[model samples]
Target: MTNILHITASIRGDESVSTGLGTALVEKLAAQSDAQVAKRDLDAETLPFVTAERFAANSAAAADRTPEQADLAAIADTLIAELQAAETLVISTPVYNFGPPASLKAWADLVARVGTTFKYTDTGPVGLLEGKKAYITAASGGTPVGSDMDFMSSWLRFFLGFLGIADVEVIAADGIMGADGEAKIKAAHQEVAKIAA
Candidate 1:
């Protein structure tokens, strides 16, 4: 069966627009593809921020790892396994000060282990996780997605691409703190419906 991984960063819980959009898309996609959905709420279950020791532990071979290293590497192991098992990924996030939240950043740091997620080549570093499709459901209060001020979407897209998830689609509700906020959100939901269709 196909697996769809939905990762949400917004702390807004029931009130998050990005999460709402992602939920709609995931429901539709799951029904259409008969896929099993795996939800990861970063806000509720925060990942560990990568430190030098944690990074070393993650890079070490499983067989060679000490008990302490094993404890440190466990989260990365689970996160990487989630990525490896999924055929589709959905990241729903709101712009926090023109960027992604600390929780999401921490998840990224943990999952991006060398020789696990990506590797170096004679040419350059190449992503190991291949042939996966990803979607971003982004909601920004004022920062416009795809604009210079919108570091969240661009950085997320680049980061995902670095993991060989190059096929990405962005669904955004930007400038939602503006006068046309409701209209923009409604429009984004409509877009989600059509995408699912």
Candidate 2:
């Protein structure tokens, strides 16, 4: 069965428009493909930000790490393993200060390990997670997706590319707090249905 890793980063919980839209799309995909989904709610299950100790642990050999470093390494290993096992990734995020949430960034920091998710080469950094598809559900209050003021989409796209997930699609629910917010959301729902189908 197809394994889908769904990561939600909305601190708003049940009231988050992005979470609602993304979850609906994932449900549709699951029903159509019989995919098994593993969810990681960043708001609910808060992940510790990457620290200097964690960095040191990542730099050392697996067998040579200190006790604290080993603990940090194991957490990173588990997160990386989840990504390695999944065929598709569904990221639900809301734009905060024109960027992604801090929790999502922390997750990225943890999973992005040297010689694990990526590696250095003579040319440049090479990403290891290849042949995986990713879908992003981004919600914003005023800033629109792909606009000059919006850093969320481009940042995410670049980060995902850095990890070798080149086949990425973004389904944005933008301008959600604007005058035509309801219409925008309705249109986004229609688009989500089309994409999910």
Candidate 3:
């Protein structure tokens, strides 16, 4: 059976548009494939930020590592294991300040380890993780399509591609502000149906 990891990054819980859409997509994906889904609510169960010590530990040779370094390395190993175990990933992200939340970035920092998820090569950087597909539900306020506004999709695509997850599908919900909020949400749901189909 296929293993799918669903990560919800919004802190808004039931009221989150990104979460709602992501949940719906997960249901659709489940119906279409015989997949076992694992959910990680990052907002509720936040991941610890990487520290300088953790960085040092990550770069150390296995035999030359101290006890503390070993512990940190073990944590990183666990994170990598969780990612590697999945055949697919679904991320629910709310755009904050025209980008993803700091918490989401922290999760990325932990998982996007050099020599683990990716490596620097002579050609540039090559992804280590392979054979994974990702779906990103991105929501933003005050920034719809065709507007001279900043969006996080570009950065997200770059980072995910660097990690070797080349097949990413994005469902974006934008312009959730002021008088157009309700309309925009309805439109976003319509878009979701199309993408999910």
Candidate 4:
């Protein structure tokens, strides 16, 4: 069976435009292909930031990890496994202070383990999670998408590409605090409908 991973980082919950867009896309995908969705709610689930001890535990050889290290690395193990298992990923993020939320960053810090998600080659680092399709449902109140001031989508797109997920699509409801905020959100949803088949 096909698996779709839905990752949400909006603290606004149901009021979040990004999360709404992602949910609509996921529902359409699940209906079209009978896919099962696995969700990681970053807002509700607080992920720990990477620490020196946690990084050591995560990078250690699985067999060599002590019991204490094992406990520390468990969340990362699960996060990586989720990324590995999903063929499609829908990430919902509302721009926070010009970038992704802290929860999302924490999640990224955990999942991006060397020799697990990606590995270093002689030339450069290579991503392992290639050939997967990803969508970024980004919502910003004032920042314009893809502009110089908008680091949210830019950073996310680059990071996903670094993980070998180059085939990505971005749906944006940017500058939603502007006069045409509702119209922009509606247009973004319409865009989702067009591509969700």
Which residue segments of model 2 deviate by more than 4 Å?
Answer: none
Compared to the true structure, candidate 4 yields what TM-score? 0.98
Cand. 3 Cα-lDDT: 0.81
What are the per-residue Cα lDDT tens digits for candidate 4 across 1-197? 79999999999999999999999999999999999999999989999999999999999988999999999999999999999999999999999889889999899899898988889999999999998999999999998888888888888888888899999999999999999999999999999999986
Winner on TM-score (2 vs 4) = 4
Q: What TM-score would each prediction reach against the true structure?
A: 0.98, 0.96, 0.89, 0.98
Reference-based lDDT, residue 139, model 2: 93
Which residue pairs does candidate 1 place in steric collision? none
- Among these predicted structures, which one has the highest lDDT? 4
Descending-TM-score candidate ranking: 4, 1, 2, 3
Give RMSD to native, each candidate. Answer: 0.8, 1.1, 2.1, 0.7
lDDT of 3 by residue, 145-175 (tens): 3344554677777788999999998886777
Count steric clashes of candidate 4: 0
30-71 in candidate 2: lDDT tens per residue? Answer: 898899999889888788887787878866778898888888
All candidates' lDDT scores? Answer: 0.93, 0.89, 0.81, 0.94
Candidate 3's error at 118, in angstroms? Answer: 0.7
> Model 1, 59-110: lDDT tens per residue?
9999999999999999899989999999999999999999999999998998
